[model samples]
Target: MMTDTDITSPVMDGMGPHGTKVGLLRVLGPAHVWALGVGIVLVGEYMGWNFAVGKGGAYAALIACWFAGILYTCVAMIDSEVTSTVAAAGGQYTQAKHIVGPLMAFNVGLYLVFAYTMLEAANAITAGYLFSVVATMTGHTGDLDQRPFIILVIMFLAWLNYRGVLATLTFNLVITAIAFVAILVLFLSTSGILGGGLMEHAALFEGHELPYGWIGVLAAMHFGLWYYLGIEGTTQAAEEVRSPARALPFGTLAGIMTLLIAATLTWYICSGVLPWEYLGDGVNGSVAPLFDTARLSGSNGLVWLLGFGTLFATLASANGCINDASRAWFAMGRDKYLPGWFGAVHPKYRTPYRSIVFLVPIALIFALGAPLDQVITFSILSGLLEYTFMPLNIIMFRKKWPLNSIKRGYEHPFHPLPALTLLTLCGITFFAVFLGYGTQLVAMIGFYIVVSLWFHFWRYRFVNRGTQFTMPWPKPQGY
Candidate 1:
């Protein structure tokens, strides 16, 4: 009598030999949840976020940080409530499918996969670059080939994920913590708490006004996502967590809280040490901004420490990206938006082994030869596209299934406030992205349109419309 909606059924992830049930391990707790989210995003603080500085100077980047922080705060709150109830592998894709419908879900799925995979590629490439920096520090390199390190990092982390979720995220937790502390170490040393004299806050800001006006702050907001790009990836753990209700809300909110602290501290520390002219160089912002700041600290120990922190942050990011992207892919496959072949979980490891392995080359494609700026823009645009849908997703979710309709793990207060805040921020961010990278923004929209057509005409047939509504709740309010 087991039905497709029966989450505990043996066939939920499809059957294996001897009729063994295979699915993701539901063993993760809140700390692992924090690690999965913070691990992916801490890399932004270490590097990519300074691009905002490049766009708007240090002051403008700070404005962008505050704005982006508000944007993701809305994301964390809204996503926490939805994912807590849905409790599925796909995160927002699952929420969209169960609440809004499959068309939106399909697009969201693609967004998640592409966003995280590209991020994974970026992290791997950065790892290779950091490795080269280490080599130069050791006095042994004209230039070391980065391809081997990039390939090695991807292959190794994908292998780690293929084995099991428990080990994968547990490893993420350790490195992510060390990396965050490294930032704190740098901050304390530079604040003169540890007897340093590198701060030039008033001196640097005296004449270095924002290169552009408020429009420049808008431009910074676009790149500001680097501060908190992948925290929503925490929700991808819904199906895998020990307690979706407790863990999803707690871990996600906690992760955002941590990011707010980390982002503010990172901006404060770096802005104090480095001038607006160098941190956000008009041509190419410092790739290793924190490390650059560290080297300026007059402490070689801090330099090596930040170096190790950078490497660990990238590794953790690539690892978390692999986890989130594969989950979205696997969830889509489970509902037949993708081939069911990807839906299979490893019989022993209880991980989405097939989906994890399949995405290796997709990530490698961008990591190997793509322009770094384009890769990052592509990733950020993908994430922004996903955020644009959140207001709709939350609005529909509440309308269809009111609070009293069923139990919820967590409920964010001020129904339309968070949703409205999310919508406004999404609008501002879209304009900001369009202002600077208008071509890429339009190109990404077109790319989604092309795939969306493919999904509408061909992929829709494979999706079982009736059966895909798997949330184990009473009938929806209107239905």
Candidate 2:
């Protein structure tokens, strides 16, 4: 096996066989990373998350979401510290390789790949569904199938990702801005601040607060998780960042704070304007909660705007997912964890063209085959497993490399407390998933086991023959 020094050597700066240099352009700044972080997750503000109301009613869902927000905040803080310190691609996967081991790193990488691609598929599906909704609302539709639209969306994003990171992220900023404005409009309208007169119906429970009681709140945890699920994608851009030590932390923290504000306003306004039961009903569950809310408020203009806005948000999210997932795949390939072809960057665009090309078909398959709820469940489960290791990674980082030795742009307060808290919350979230969807949990475990075994038996030998897995820490003197 290659030693840490071998892996961290300057000579192996992603030089593939035949002396090909596989790398990305460092054209992104803090603002771009921030836009990516928000863009990747803005869809949740428009849809998906409100499905929690279906499980626990409005009040119970709100409580669950609030708790989930806290957990995500702790996670974001810890992740920022790691991102600033390590400043590498692949986010949690890179962090885990240095702090844990290669095996854990492979697992995390695979999990992230699954989570992000599935999220992209989910967003594509949502986009198609929203388009159908818009068509019907506009009184022009006959036998509309969303599957073709989903495929088109996947193809479009794949093409965008292959073009270049600068162009992709520039577009991301514009769409993300539009998405934010869309949410702001919804908040103002539903809050009666826009003279919508919808706040008069703002009742908390109205006899439908907790249909499944506290147990329902547990069930809602996964749905609530949707609100902040993709915020961590910011760290995946470390390799492409202009100054990762400063940009990663600032971008990630800014993204988290913005999502928190948006989540709160979205939940409060949507629940207030519409009956909790109506919002929680199965038919409208995850399909178009926001659109339905605007429709109920007697605003055709608002509904039209939100429908288009939801499409923009979902497309932006799908685009961001491709960007993040391609980087993780690229990182793994560059390190020889998988085939080297996956690590290849476009000569002209400086993006992971191969990985982006690879994921397009997979996303299309997922969009066509799986139900939206199942897609969400699997995505959340995979994400939670990846998240469970982050706190432990933090503790290990501090132990292996003292903080004083590293140049950190940001650090979490209270030392290990945030890590511990995040760990506990992760456990709770995992248990909630198990309690609610036992079969899905079993399937997720089986998937992880299979992937782990494949790595150990087949891929490990190949990767070990050529490359050494190492952390991105500065070498000590005389090493």
Candidate 3:
């Protein structure tokens, strides 16, 4: 009974309240809105070591924010343009298929899967870390190991996403709000103790050595990408957005800008309260940096509260990544770049059951590979590569062959300038990751590029051939 149009409609069947209603109108408001972008960046802050390394001896939190603003702005613009054109579920893969080519699109899709899967794994590992912190503070251990903890978290996240977008967003809002409060409390406590109050010393106006050269600035920009990694998550929800053309772009840009400012403020206040020396591997490397700060500030009660808050933040970030990655797979599967199973929606839940099942093992492997900072750095580096390609896709689409058939909703303010700036920053990020992480990172990246290239040429055969194995593109929508 399902018509061809129904299969590809903006509001597909499944994934609604009671599994009956269409679920495309789950417009994310400001609360759940900020969570998507901000939560991603906050992870680096919660895991303080990365911030310390990137921030160096200089207190450049504010300047870092300024630079983050620029980088995120470009990412937002490029994501918006693409999401508007193909507002269905296929996210990056869908856009790249249209602009770049089916094979390149497939590669990007796979990269996203790997990136987000690792993100989820990282979160699950952090969850165990948070639980351990709470246990250590409360003086109780309930037989919880990291591996079991990871499995439980993944299952819970899968259930949450399966419930519906509205439920997921609502939960996201609550957790994100708590996380925000935790951040504020962290800043205040850190400032109250240090010689200079949070505002005076933490402002990061002084002591930064500006990279005198372009390469230096770019090098600095490399470590900073983690501060703005999740700016494009909003695009994954394009199907549910009120106006894909307008809302997707606006929401994405707004989210990135907001996160940039918040991260700057957090770094400033945190650095001011506690010197980098006090934060060691346990606190900096663990999930509850704020709790460590609370303990150092000599407030036991606040430390407990911060423990709860940090747990919430880590869970939120992990949940968001899991949800986003599954959707990306669903989109690609729907396009026939991936297996048909991934494309199939659960008849009742309206969620991508096939993709979720496929994603679980990958996430598990990533979680095991985790437990090290270098692993996280590598995962984040790959993500930067994805971000870099986004702007390139926009330029390619415009110059090589325009997607004029698609209606435009939101366009970038500065045309190619923003895209060009984004392109340059991404190059900086690539080199910085290379320098900071070294040869292993390079080998990893080389592997990714080679794999991506292989799949495109051999697997899909450029989608235009209308292969029966691939997901058939719906008849072009009537203009």
**Best of the candidates, TM-score:** 1
Better of 1 and 3 by lDDT: 1
Which 10-residue window of candidate 1 scores lowest in summed lDDT?
Answer: 1-10
State the lDDT of candidate 3 residue by residue for 1-479, as single tens digits. Answer: 11122222433422331133433344555445456656655665566333533434333333445575688778777787766655666577667765666666776776677777777777788888777656665787576566777788988987888767667867877787777777776665666553434444434324443323344444555556666666677767766655555666666766776676557656665555544434323334423445655666666767776777777777887777777788889877665566555667766666777787788888887787656565566567667767777887888756643444334565567778988888887766666666666686778768877877677567565333443222223333331
Q: How much lDDT does candidate 1 score?
A: 0.87
Task: List model 1 lDDT by residue over 233-285, tens digit each.
Answer: 99898878777788889999999999999999999988998878678762355
lDDT of 2 by residue, 1-479 (tens): 21232222333333333255756777888889988999988888788877788877787678877888888888889999887766667888878876677889999998888889999999998888877876786797696888888888899889989999988998999989888888888878777687745764435566665788898888788678888898988988877877777888899899999998988888877787767766766354436667777777777878877877788889889999999888889888877788978878799988889999998888888899998878888889888988888888888877766666665668888879888888888887877787778899998899889989999888887675423544444643233
- Residue 94 in model 2: shift from native, Å? 1.2
- For TM-score, candidate 2 versus 3, the one ahead is 2
Model 2 pairs whose backbones collide? none
Model 2 CA deviation exceeding 4 Å by range: 1-22, 200-204, 282-286, 465-479
Ranked by lDDT from best down, the candidates are 1, 2, 3
Order of the predicted models by TM-score, top scorer first: 1, 2, 3
| Candidate 3 global lDDT | 0.63
Show where candidate 1 strays beyond 4 Å. Answer: 1-20, 282-285
Candidate 1, residue 285: lDDT: 52
List clashing residue pairs in candidate 1.
none
Alpha carbon lDDT at 387, candidate 1:
89
1 or 3, greater by TM-score: 1
- lDDT score of residue 57 within candidate 2: 77
The pairs that clash in candidate 3 are 14-350, 15-349, 15-350, 190-273, 336-471
